[model samples]
Target: MSSPQFSFATTAEEVATAFSNEIKGKNVLITGTSLNGIGSETARVIAKHANLVVVTGYNEARLKATEDALKKENSSANIRRLVLDLSSLAAVRKAAAEVNSYSEPIHVLIHNAAAAIGPLNLTVDNLDSQLATAHIGPFLFTKLISPKLLAAGTSGYVPRVVWVSSGAHAFATGIDFDALRKPNKEGYQAMVAYAQAKSANVLMGIEISKRSKGRVNGYSLHPGVIYTNMNQKPESIAEMQAIGILDADGKPSTEKFEWKSIPQGAATTVAAAFDPSLNATPGAYLDDSTLANDKVGAHCLDAANAKKLWEVTEEIVGEEWVF
Candidate 1:
């Protein structure tokens, strides 16, 4: 399929406006919507079009703040808050159940939250912290809410699951199944673990697209290199420099990088979720608001690996989520 002719400079608000008629009255659920983050911006833009916008975060204070910000943007906006801590499997499941209890079909599910450059650690579930927070928790949450997404299809809406993957997936060797199953401090490399989780996110989208068979569309995207709270911390900045994402002076490298504004970073995600051109192309990898033909690595597009990831994720989550 030919890539869409979208300007790389487009912002989330523009994308949302372009599709406002189509997405009006739709219900959207977005994760990791803390203040001043891409997810928050995405949710804000989406609220302009969607009937109900649910923003979630681990911190109650931040979640409330985000809801308040959205309300401020549009006082009449129907916004809800879900307290979700992706680091815990139990919390993810409970949150998913709460979303389900709303009795409203979910038209779009955006897995926009992620943990980056954090210390090596294990969750109570014994899974790698990065993997659990970034992939596993979102994977399970998606599974539980899929029925709602599928039901929305009956109304002629093209329900979507948007996985916010990163270009960093290109740096990962592959999924270390053993390490994910039993992560030890000695075996953990923070960036590598994060890369693996990002790769898994892409694979999860591919697998979900296959299983849903058109009832629900899935897409993964690299929301360009943006300076957000997730990657702007001192530790995260040091790691970015080490990985050549930034320069010694703490600025993005001009030669190979162009940092995106928060809204700009969210353009591709908004495009993937509502672009009519993508209706026939589920499981595509998008970057810079267009289909990325070659930038997505072979590993991320591996079907067999995607299936394996689906299976392993089910096992880790201790639930059979048949689509």
Candidate 2:
């Protein structure tokens, strides 16, 4: 399939304009939409086009701030906010049920929420925090809301689920299911755990596309190495400074690398969610606002691994999502 006309330089707002006519009455949902992150920016642009836009995050203040900001930016924008902590299964279930209660079928679901480079820990559900937040929680939420997506498809809307993965998935050799199932502090590393979770995100996209059998499309993408709050921890800043990625004042060192602007970073996500060219090619991995030619990783593309991960995820979430 041919890629969309968009390129790496395309901004989220431009992508929205390109699809505004078609998306005017669509229902879109996005997670992890804090004030200035990619999720929020994507939602901001989509809100201008979509009939209803649902923004979600774990922080109440940030969620409200985003909601207010979106309304402030476009007074006529139809927007809603919901609390969704991807680390908590209970919270995910409640949020999914609440979203399901809405009369409109969801036309697009963007899994833009993720936990990266956080301390190794376990959630109340006994799963690794990074894995739970980045994969398991979203997995359960997607399964719960899939019926809505299918319904939207039946009604002539192209329903899509976009997973915001990272190129970091290439850093991990493969997913250590045993370690993820029972984390051990002796060998835990934040980035490695994050990479594993990201690989799982890609695998979930592949599996969902296969399971949905074209009723709903699934996509995963590397949103580029944009500077975001998730990577602005004191430790992270110090590490980046050491590597010359950031300076002492916590700004990008342009000579070393050019970090993507927020809109540029969100362009691919916006494209993945609404690009008509991708409707025929579900489960595609995208980067720089285009379909990635290189493999994300061997394990990420393994059908057997994707199926196993899906089964284990269902067991961990304590729910069976029969498609």
Clashes of each: 0, 0
How well is each residue in 71-155 modelled by candidate 1, as lDDT tens digits? 9979999999999999898898899899889979999999998876866766888777789888989988988877888888965
Candidate 2 lowest-lDDT run of ten: 234-243
Query: Model 1: residues >4 Å from true position, as ranges?
Result: 1-4, 248-255
Candidate 1: global Cα-lDDT? 0.85
- lDDT string for model 2 (140-159, tens) is 89988887887788545558
What pairs collide in candidate 1?
A: none
Candidate lDDT (C-alpha), each: 0.85, 0.85
lDDT of 1 at 277: 79
